[model samples]
Target: MLLQRRALLGATAVLAAPSLARAQAPSWAARYPELVFAIIPSENASGVTERYGPFVNYLSRRLGTRVTLRIANDYAAVIEGQRAGNIHIASYGPSSFARALMTGAQITAFAIETNLDGTKGYYSVFYVKADSPYQRVEGLRGKNLGLVDPNSTSGNNVPRFALNKMGINPEQFFGRVVYTGSHENAVIALGQGTVDMAANWWNDEQESNLLRMERKGMVRAADFRIIFKSDQIVNSPVAYLNTLPDELKAAIRTAVLEVHRADEAAFNRIYEGKQGPLEAVDNAAYEPIIELNRFVDNLRRRG
Candidate 1:
């Protein structure tokens, strides 16, 4: 009876071992040990740091979690970090968000940068030197057009989509196409006449870059023309890895939307204008972008 009882106890111990290990297993919070959010810097690192450091620290305090801000040198690195699960949350351009979702990241919230006629959406504007004689989209024919990046929604995808609507094949439409890697670089290329035209995301005509160029006398409202514009896309999204726990995910979603109300000034700088409060959203909201991508892909296939 003693031996039989011993065997039964041993079996029970073995049965309980897996549960014990699971109970002791590190949680998402434990494994990460902290929360990190990444932002892609269009400006120089120093400018970004000076502009956003205080805001980052404030978010850390509010969330009651250790928070670190990561400034990616370029857009791809930002998305790649999120895809690998090293970055917990990110502010992603619509195109970047699309790419992240394709690779399995989940979008939880999006910012509304402006109130255009009481609606929140932004568009990509195609810019050319103000002095250029090109008056319309068709004028871009046989002229070099600068594209910011292959993955850029405003810089690449929107222009291509706009071109398609104009019945022009983007690849064959421009005399030459160059990718400048960022919207800032694209603007520079256009200002310096390195390319005949470039695309960028903007809401207000009074944006800093537009004002700067006008002040420099390099380009003016009359100097450049928006050859094409695309439908309003929901602004950049704050995305998370699918691997994150639902509870933690819910918390992040709540914080992003509520943080604006908690600290308005910091939120304004981080968003780069009147990019006001965030709204709860999910990946499905970007179905239009996905469809646009597919249309572009199909055109490539047919061509």
Candidate 2:
């Protein structure tokens, strides 16, 4: 009887071992049932969805979790969401990402957009209507100027840095400065003659606001003239909240890096790239923007 009881006890222990291991195992889905992916509203919300829906769906499949795209109303909304841990992943403009870091947002950049030539940066450009008398930054003096957003690197920071380097203070140089709210709207404002001049991003290739607008019939490239263009500012970055588990973060990075391989056309269109893959990035990539931000802040305080 004693031998039979001992054998039965051993079998019971073996049966319970797998269940115990299953209970102790980590479950990413249980910890994070869903992730909120936020994008800066460089364009309208609907446009963002239309442009990124497929990419987001791909990410959801890759991560084996639900990924919802959240179109932020403005740059600050994205920054604040990440800061509050509400946004798990975000695509941020250079200046906005710098601001997020400067303000203590717990996030880390894992990927950045790249061009076909493997270049990972773009430029900031100042534009005026082709027929406008303004031929240069100086020509726009005393005229209304449109800036996309304060936190926008291409639309605001880079433009301010370039103008300051040229000894041109936008506030004092222009009759009035207007925030058009987005790069797309800034272009629209310039085309509609709402603002005499506007600052935005230009890749100098097929990937630029001008080209995007031209493709959509919103504005003709011939209808606008580039007055000034700044040197290469790194393209926007894709970041994940730091609070995420290490395993999940690694998976997220791997998924994004492989996205181009899975669907090159969709990836290129989503990022406005020239058929290039997403590349790994770090905070060091944005050191220039950090310095630029400091310079702009000083200029603002003095002004």
Estimate every model's Cα lDDT from 0 to 1. Answer: 0.66, 0.82
Question: Where is the poorest 10-residue window by lDDT in model 2?
Answer: 5-14
Give per-residue lDDT, candidate 2, residue 132: 78
The parts of candidate 1 lying over 4 Å away from their true place are 1-29, 106-118, 206-223
lDDT by residue (tens digit), candidate 1, 70-168: 777666777667766777877777776776666555444444334434455778888878678887878778888888766678888888888888898
Clashing pairs in 2: none
lDDT of predicted model 2:
0.82
Candidate 2: tens digits of C-alpha lDDT, residues 1-303: 001101000000000111224454446657876677888888876678777777777777777677777887678878888888988999999999998888888899999988788898899998899887887788777899999988999999889989889999989999999999899999999888889999998876576888887877777889888888899989889999999999899989998899988866658667655447889999899888888888888888889
Q: Please name the candidate that would achieve the greatest TM-score relative to the true structure.
A: 2
**Which candidate wins on lDDT?**
2
Candidate 1: clashing pairs of residues: 130-223, 130-224
